[model samples]
Target: MAEPVADQNSALPDSPPDGQGEATEPTNANREAAKYRTKLREAEAKLEATEKRVNALLRAQVESLAAKELSVASDIFDIGGASIDDLTDPEGNVMSDAVDAAVKALLAKRPGLRNGSAPWGDVGGGRRGSIPDAPPTMLEALKFTRR
Candidate 1:
């Protein structure tokens, strides 16, 4: 019988350079890196969602506090014949003047109310000082009904 040939697949001292084991290190590293990237993205998404929820809660709380303060202020000023709506004019109606004066007085006495201008104003001229044109009379408003 012919001598058995050496198993060509076995590692041998004289193996050709091109016949070395497969270069799996690069591929393995790439797979591991991709997995890490995916996990990082997921973590970032979760953090963003949490931040959004926190922001929403904060906004809701602030709104609630502001509404309560507005209601209390309305009750206090109603005694002086000043309503909230009347104090929102450009030229500063009587009620607006009263409210401004009251705010200033409170700021002087308490020192904390001086954080900024009172939330009362048609400031910036966007919708504050501009007057709404008068609505048409009943007859004019109903002109379309006749046809």
Candidate 2:
């Protein structure tokens, strides 16, 4: 028996219908939306980096201002729980008046934070005695005896 011939006018199983094939091509709206999404992501990342830099600068300014009046600025940052925003204005500029007020308030509350105030006694060798005029011999050194 002979095999039957396939018809040329019939649609193939692997190919989509003629009118529906246009859907496979991307539309201008889709391309524009993708472009905007990429731009948005880049903008968000840049904003985050800028915020980190601004916060670091503000923190340094706060510490420098505090250091001028106090021996330990970390004590104020740690104990007072102060934020960088507290020392800076809405425009991200350091507010010297606010910083001065904060330092004064902290010093009033913690008198010890003031500069030139020693927390402990002077650190030195405890009552060191004068050494002998002559150097000891190796044998005397090995003896471990004190003058």
Residue range 28-145, candidate 1, lDDT tens digits: 7899999999999999999999978865554344333333324334333433343344444454223434455554554455554233434765445554564758967889869978
In terms of lDDT, the best-performing candidate is: 2
Backbone clashes in model 2, listed as residue pairs: none
Whole-model Cα lDDT per candidate? 0.54, 0.80
Candidate 2 lDDT over 27-120, as tens digits, reads 6569988999999999999999999997887888788888887888766578666777787888879888888888888888988878775466
Candidate 2: residue 56 lDDT (0-100): 80
User: For model 1, which pairs clash?
Assistant: 122-128
lDDT of 2 at 14: 53
